[model samples]
Target: MAERPRTLYDKIWDDHLVHEQEDGACLIYIDRHLVHEVTSPQAFEGLRVSGRKVRSPERTLAVVDHNVPTTDRSKPIEDPESKAQVEQLAINAAEFGVEYYNEHDARQGVVHIVGPEQGFTLPGSTIVCGDSHTSTHGAFGALAHGIGTSEVEHVLATQTLIQKKAANMLVRVDGRLAEGATAKDIILAIIGEIGTAGGTGHVIEYAGEAIRDLSIEGRMTVCNMSIEGGARAGLVAPDEKTYAYLRGRPKAPQGEMFDAACRYWDSLRSDEGAHYDRIITLDAASLPPTLTWGTSPEDVAPITGAVPTPDSVANPAKRAAIARALDYMGLKGGEKLTDIAIDRVFIGSCTNGRIEDLRAAAAMIAGKKVSERVNAMVVPGSGLVKAQAEAEGLDKIFLAAGFEWREPGCSMCLAMNPDRLAPGERCASTSNRNFEGRQGYKGRTHLVSPAMAAAAAIAGHFVDVRSWR
Candidate 1:
């Protein structure tokens, strides 16, 4: 009898397995450990208490992002708590001998953005971080996920983590995407189809022609939001696009080593007839630029659609959830999204703050000015991204269009620093989450594509970018 074929997740998991314990947990080697200011303080403290040094400091990389201010970064961080967190991360990294990127470093940015840009995240590697968006690295065919402070300590102390194998899930998107549709829309549509908890207990492998056609940056955008759908991690099988993006990256292998690495990465895909615990397919051509009308990412609809009525839902629990979300968002049932006005617009985050995203928004709003009623801002994901955007005059485009072009940081994405929405303010945001008070206390968030957010900034209301185009 022949053995069954294995999935990409299974292959990667097996390759990294250090030891399988009787409790069904395995010790897996970590190839990369990305750290951010907000979550590593406790783990560093743990190492201090136990009198243990980092087992492999070379494998760990730290950056100050979450707690850094996007405004006047040269000035002292105004928020005392945030300043303390950033300072602590620097102290910890120095004491641990781990490479640290401070706010002043040109490479410094969001941990997820900096990792890929610097080639620290590689294909067929096992990566872990204390941040939930660590799944963003899986776009390069790596197995990565967010862990707690305890797990962070374990990885730091031993360069390994104990974990149970996650069930496999395949999310295949077929056909070509529509003109105005983007990777953001595709993922939003999937979340809408499956709901917020759809991928719980699973690692999603995105496959099919549509996914294969997306640019490496676009693929990252899709994988970055997998956590929003409750997936432990998300992955994409790497190909030429992935190799092209990694080829000259700062940490990528050179010459013969690069060729050898590619050969191995090429083989890191699901075998024919591999079994998945679940499979879902979506038609890409039918998907429109989508937006989240309620508090959850799963509460999505086409840009032209209206807010859903709670009474329309059949599930009692879900109906109540919709009701609560509607009340919190200050939305009325059957309200057309286009009729809703926005007080502000935010275009940045790990999900869509890459150079490609900046270019898209810049092209959309080049000649048009932001609505007089709207306060719009653009924050790059990293210092590298910021420099590249300026080189292309994207910052000038944004500023000319009345959009404030700010420094790089995870600005207004989770409101960790001074950038945040006021209470009762509604925004058209290009970030991932839209949970209640995510942008600020009582701030309502409408998740959108970069182009859509740009259009909203100009129109002061939600409008279909396809029509604008």
Candidate 2:
């Protein structure tokens, strides 16, 4: 008989599966179902059309972050498209009996942030969301991933998904990251080297030295971008760092149950001499603080690096893509990233709007003022994150530095929130995604780490922030 396999993804996927399909797919039970405004409308409509109730209402959690206004929530949305989306989500949740964190609720924010903060994202379970960033919850040791609309319907009807096993890929980073580098930089460099789709059809198991030293928020950021690399999911092996973060979380077990949970989490690591379908090793010493130069996160370079010229590229396809990015961004090839000025700097999103991220931004800009030319905002990711930052005086620091510190919501990341850039406004932002017109029509976005964003606000360009430290 073959020895049993115990990969982390396998362990969780096998444990929660209620049945196996004829096509080798597993009907895996969903432990947490996070829903936001954009994708839930048709889902709820589907439920109504078929007279199907939510399979497990308690497991299905809803929040209105994407389409709600960030600062002004006094009345209904003025934008016709935005107004209809929010109203539909409310109606859907009410009819289905699923818990809805409305715009006025304290729990309202990005689905990923709300899910973890509410203590619903426990370890040793499966979580699915209609949003791709659902991999953020994998930092808690849960096997989480995004689902399509069809899978969303499946969860509503049966609270399960028919999923095939993803090949396991181990990414081992051996060495502590130097000061000024973050998990963001590490993942950015990895994607830069591996290309965007390097992890297709695989579950990335982040391991080795550098990743172990990352904070939980940092790990969440790293895993949050898993989909950017075309990976099904990304995870860190559970450890002291993971436990310390989850210990006081509302949903984590307490006392003996907690102790037992930790023991099981410890056992989640790859066994001695375990094999992976693929292995990619990273040297932490070689990395530098970086930013994306093109639409894709994979199109990145060092903070001070220059844009690549099309003629400098040998491949015509590559040349065209780079050329298009430069045109849309109003940038030129071989120009220094520092020379690129911006009209705004935004610090908030599911990617970098947590308490720790706020502190990091505050640390960078404390006793300094934002550039007069730069309009900046700091929107928290959750009500809990907002309250915690306020208690710590982080909000005071942000406002003192000329940042408009607003309430929690998705904000400018996905433009599902009211906060968005105007046409032709270039921005240095901590949110992910720099696709053409992502923030607004013809609005250009340059993605960076939170600390880098604060530094850019102070300097009015993509300046290296390590000097401040």
TM-score, every prediction: 0.99, 0.96
Q: Rate the local accuracy (lDDT) of all candidates.
A: 0.94, 0.85
* lDDT per residue (tens digit) for residues 244-356 in model 1: 99998988898889999999999998999999999999999999999999999999999888999999989999899989999999987899999999999999999999999
RMSD of each: 0.9, 1.6
Task: Give lDDT tens digits, candidate 2, residues 305-334.
Answer: 898888988999999999999898888889
Q: Model 2 residue 382 lDDT?
A: 89
Candidate 1, residue 171: Cα displacement in angstroms equals: 0.3
